[model samples]
Target: MSDLRDLYQELILDHTKRPRNFGQLATANRKAEGFNPLCGDRVTVHLELDGDTVREIHFEGSGCAISTASASLMTEAIKGLRVEDARALFEQVHKLVTGASGPNGGGPSLGKLVVLAGVRDYPIRVKCASLPWHTLCAALSGGDETVTTE
Candidate 1:
């Protein structure tokens, strides 16, 4: 268990140190910004949808390691998925991080995202980890307003 925890920590650190898809997308057709007032995490999610598929996705933001890594991992996870699939994934990730379900408890198969399950132990950090995901929802739904976790 300790070894697994160390691996999870390492994964999070890796994504934080060098986040994936951390930039603006010139061709994005949908975009949304998110702010978490509790921890001052802010993120903007951009997407390019080809029909129902996400042809491209990117983000730009400044936040805690959790927030950064979550955004990074999120972009990677949802890139090739359809818009509706991406939305379902958001719910899965939300449950995974919030302890509504566990990796072995018949939750959505999180794959690389399982590393974030430890976040459930630190309730406050859940907001940090999920900031980008909520922003993604807003982006996908075409909501121009900034999503906030108050």
Candidate 2:
């Protein structure tokens, strides 16, 4: 329990137990749906953007601990960041969880997201860590409710 996992244990567990943005945002102007057919983890992300910044976010999903926790953290992380920054953060998580580290050790900007790096050790769980990012991209791009991931 002395590892970085210890540092983020509360963070990840809290998110999983009471996942943030875990509902449908009534005010969302953009929304996207994501599903992991392999694991049957499904979610719909609702986003409210104030120009380039995300003013609010919400989601509803059925997934494993990793997916739920990642979504919770993703919502909190992108609160005030610009769209570009959020996109960068998504890429960071993707690389980190997939074991293909990005430049600068793969997450210089996303501090706690690094906690999920252990997800790389489990290939199946990697998708759980990435679901939110895919949904985020769909929402940002004004896509209709239909996006999928592995």
Candidate 3:
């Protein structure tokens, strides 16, 4: 268990130091901004949808390691997924990080995103970890107002 935790920590730090898909997408058709006032984390999620599938996704922002890594991992996870699938994935990840899913809940595997499950241990950090996901939801829903974790 300790080894697994260390691996998770390493993965998180890797994503934080060098986030994947971190940039603006010139061809993005949908975008949304998010702010976490609790920790002053801000992020913008951009997406290019090919019909109902996400053809590309990117994000740009300055935030805590958790926020940045979550955005990075999210973009990687959702890039080739259909919008509906991505939304479902968001729900799964939300449950994982928020401790809403109990042991043996048997949720679908989150793959690389399972690393985020650790955030549930830190109540306040939960907001930091979820900021990007909330922003992605806004972009998917075509919301113009900035999403806030207040």
Candidate 4:
């Protein structure tokens, strides 16, 4: 368990230092911003949808390591997925990080994203970790208003 935790930590740090898909997408058709007032984390998610599938996704922001890494990992996870699948993933990840998952455990395969589940141990930081996901949700729903974790 300790080894697994260390690996997760390393992965988070790697993503934080070199976030994947971190930039603006010139071809983006949808975009949304998110803010976590408690931690002062802000992020914007951009998406290019080819029909119902995400052809490309990107994000740009300055935030805590958790927030940045979550955005990075999220972009990687949802890039090729259909919009509905991405939304479902958001729900699963929300449950995982909020400790709201059922006894069956992690509640489906979140792959590398499971690393973020550790944030649940730190109540306040949960908002930090989930900030990007909320922003992504807003983008998917075509909401222009900024999502806030208040």
Number of the predicted model whose lDDT against the real structure is largest: 4
Clashing pairs for predicted structure model 4, backbone only: none
lDDT of 3 at 37: 79
Candidate 4, residue 14: CA error in Å?
0.3
Question: Which stretches of model 2 miss by more than 4 angstroms?
Answer: 1-8, 102-105
Decoy 4 TM-score against native: 0.92
TM-score per candidate: 0.92, 0.88, 0.92, 0.92
**lDDT score of model 2?**
0.83
Clashes of each: 0, 0, 0, 0
Of candidates 2 and 1, the better by TM-score:
1
Query: Which 10 residues in a row give candidate 3 its minimum summed lDDT?
Result: 101-110
Whole-model alpha-carbon lDDT for candidate 3 = 0.88
- Report how far residue 136 has shifted in candidate 1, in Å: 0.2
Please give the TM-score that candidate 2 achieves against the real structure. Answer: 0.88
Q: Residues 10-98, candidate 3, lDDT per residue (tens digit)?
A: 88999999999999999999999999877779999999988999999999999988898899999999999998999999898888888
Residue runs of model 4 more than 4 Å from their true location after superposition: 1-8, 102-108
Question: For residues 119-145, could you state the per-residue lDDT of candidate 4 as single tens digits?
Answer: 877777888888999999999999999
> How would you encode candidate 2's per-residue C-alpha lDDT over 44-148 as one tens digit per residue?
888999998889988888888888889988888887888998898888788888878943447467787777777776776788889888998999999897788
